[model samples]
Target: MNPKVTDYISSNIKWQKELEIIRNVLLELPLEEDIKWGIPAYIYKKKNIMGLSAFKNYCGLWFHHGCFLKDEINILINAQKDKTKGMRQMRFISVDEIDTDIVKQYVLEAMANSEAGLEVKPKKNTNPVVIPEELNIQFSKNEKLKYKFNEFTLSKQREFCEYILSAKREATKQSRIEKIIPMILNKIGLNDKYRNC
Candidate 1:
């Protein structure tokens, strides 16, 4: 275990024993420790394998490719109802909620799947728009907007694009574009604009 991660684990005692057990299972796998999404993440060859996190009422062991695994142990939970596939979470309400052996087997299987390059096929895009022509045109015409949009993080850009293109009607798309233009021109991300308000 990485010393930093060990220290992180040691700092929290609410579910110390349970966390320890889960840690042992994860450490046994050939994985590397890194910080991702502001939390301790385990990766195999650059692909995320799993992550450890704590919540107000529960702690979770997240398998990045959990949706791809044939979960006979029935350990997976659908955290989001709208998401059809790609990620799943196993939440533990308390120390006693953990099943060490079963969790270990799941961890092992997750690692094996990672090593084998297994992946859940991404959901196909169902939106009607074939990329926004306005986005390209607006971006090309405005150097400041282009710079700001480029400066925004990948997730932020994705959010903006998804929000704009998510509209089913042309009027809604135009309205979204109108709302987003100033935010982009000002070098502010979609969430940042809302957050500051």
Candidate 2:
């Protein structure tokens, strides 16, 4: 067991036993175990295969390429139906909720899929990204900002645009623009803090 993952699972005061059972089951597989996003993640050839996470209500397994799994028993769930594409989660409310045999089958399938080089293709961004007027003006005024904004990936650009547009008032929009200008200049994504973790 990875010391970091052991510490993380042991620290789950609310679901220690549940987390430990999940951890032990995963350990029986061939994947390498490590800590990621403060959770126990199983990796195959440096690619994330599955991860264990504890939430307020449950501890769950996050299957990285779950979109590709056959899921013959129909247990895999799309945690975020619309936003999540490749990942799926199998949630457990308690240690008793875990069916070790079923879980093992799923893990083995996932490991096999990884070994077979199966993957879920990223969804293509088809719609044109919406750029708010506040950002448009900023881009027009500063060549560097314009260049930097253009340099961002389509998703990053969309995040910034959505953030600015979500503000209800002009002042709020302007405030958001001001706050994000440095981040744009630095080429950082709007949700980098959350995503990086």
Candidate 3:
């Protein structure tokens, strides 16, 4: 057992017992345990099989390649319906809901899937970039901003455009535009910082 995962389980106030139960069950298998992105991930054949996490309303079991699971009971959910394609989550609201038998079965199936080369590929971001109305208005008023925006590649431009378009409220759209102006002028992609890291 990884000490970090142990500490992670013990330190979690909301889902400590739940995490430990799931951990104990998974530990019985061949999966190597490790912390990835601050969550306890189970690995097999050097690939991530599943991750366990606690959310505000529920604790979740994240199957990295869950799209391959049979999901006969139909519990898996794509958290982000439109955006999430490959990853799926099985949510649990209470300790009693953590059926060890079902979990073990699912995990074993996931391992088999991994061994057989079953997989889901991430879809490439090839959709045409639609510059939000707000951003076009900014370009109209500020030629320098337009010039800077044009400096980035299409992908980067699309990222910024999508970022603004994702905001729900009018004020939020304006706020997003204001935020990206400096980034655009500095020739920074919206996700450059994280992507570089």
Candidate 4:
């Protein structure tokens, strides 16, 4: 067991028992502890294998390969609605809610999946709008904004541009552009400011 992670989890009584149970189960596996998304994440090799966290009403045992796992326990929850094929979550309302046998099976399967090299299907691109001429004009006018936008990686630029052009109405598109211009100028990528670094 990792002393740092155990110490962190020990502070929360409700989560302590749950973490202890999970830690005991995964004892034989090669594991490391790190903080990810502000939660305690467990890694196998270099891949994120699982995470333990508490929510408002439940504690979560998240599987990084959950979307691919055959959930015999039927306790897994699809946490992300926008993405169809990545990282499923298993929520436990209480320590009693966990099925230790099933969780161990899942951990073993996840390790095997990692060894076999499986990846989630990438999300499809749904937006089809081209960049507006007016937006291009605005970008051209602000040299700093243009430079900042250029400094962003292709994927990051695509995210901001897609967000602006994806709106159904011209008014909404303009509104989004207005809201995002300062973010672009500040060299912050979409979702970067909100995500815990």
Candidate 5:
């Protein structure tokens, strides 16, 4: 059990009771509980099986590989439509909506699927990394940074490239480039901080 998850559930004034009701069912599963993405997540074999979260309007469960579930109850919905590939959400508005027995059944099935090596592997990002003009200008100024950047895996290089391009204004792009120079030189990936959790 992670102390952070206690703070998470306790902090949600709107859905604390409802979340706790569902959490009781999740607790019965043979999974390790910890916090990931700053939310309560249950792990099986080091893979995230599900997570608990709260919003202003609702509290919900996030199934990490929910696409594989039979979902005969029709409770699962893709939270992000086309943008989200495999994750599905089962949202609840109140304590009355929870059915612990069904929840347990779903979790047991998900665990079985996970143990069977079922997964929705994301398509490979084959598109070439596009270096923004601002980044190119910076690279021209600091040749060593450019040299070091190429040493990284394509995914890492693309992360840095997109980081600069994602900023709307020129100043923001320049600042983002400046911010990442040290990281690039040190061979650090941009999202490294969140990756472990």
Candidate 6:
């Protein structure tokens, strides 16, 4: 067992027992236990099989490639159905809801699926760059900003686009664009502040 995972479970005030029950069940499988995303992630053949976590309302397991699992029993739930394609979760509000034998069956099935090479293809970001109208106008008028924005990677450009477009109000969007123009001129990514030193 990962000591971090053990500590995480024991430290949970609301779902400690529920988390421990799921952890104990997962530990019995062939999957290697490791800590990932600050939770217990089980792996087989170095591929993520499942991860255990405690949410505010529920404790559950996220099956990494769960889209490929045959849900004849229909135990899986698409937590983000529209956005999440490859992953699925099984949530439990109480420890009694965790049927250990059934969970073992699902775990074994996930292992088999992994062994069979079933997988979800990664989603491609295929849409063209979504430059806001204000930013586009600015880009056309300011040659330096235009040159710097064009010099940025596709991801960096998309990051700026998403940041500006995520604003709900037109004024907010304009304000965001104005705020980022200097950063663009400095050739900085929108997430530069959060990047590691």
Using lDDT, give the best candidate's number: 3
TM-score of each: 0.65, 0.83, 0.69, 0.72, 0.88, 0.75
Give per-residue lDDT, candidate 6, residue 117.
93
Comparing 1 and 6 on lDDT, the stronger one = 6
Please report the candidate that would top TM-score against the real structure. Answer: 5
Stronger candidate by TM-score (2 vs 4): 2
lDDT of each: 0.77, 0.88, 0.88, 0.76, 0.87, 0.86
lDDT of 5 by residue, 28-137 (tens): 77888888777899999888899999998888989989999999989998979878888988888888888888888889989999999998888989999999888788
Pick by TM-score: 3 or 6, better one = 6
Model 1 per-residue lDDT tens digits across residues 1-80: 67767766777778667677788777777779865665568888788888888776878788888877789878798787
Once fitted onto the true fold, the runs of candidate 4 whose alpha carbons sit more than 4 angstroms away are: 1-20, 23-28, 121-129, 132-137, 165-179, 193-196
The pairs that clash in candidate 1 are none
Query: Comparing 3 and 4 by TM-score, which wins?
Result: 4
- List model 2 lDDT by residue over 1-197, tens digit each: 88989888778889899888877888887789987776788998778898899999888899989988888878789978888888999999987889988888888888889889998878678789999988999988999998999999998899999999999999999999999999999988888876665
4 or 6, which is superior by TM-score? Answer: 6
> In candidate 2, which residue pairs clash?
none
lDDT of 6 at 155: 81
Question: Lowest-scoring 10 consecutive residues by lDDT in candidate 6?
Answer: 188-197
RMSD of each: 6.2, 2.5, 4.1, 3.9, 2.0, 4.0
RMSD of 6: 4.0
lDDT of 3 at 195: 54
Question: What would the C-alpha RMSD of candidate 3 be, to one decimal place?
Answer: 4.1
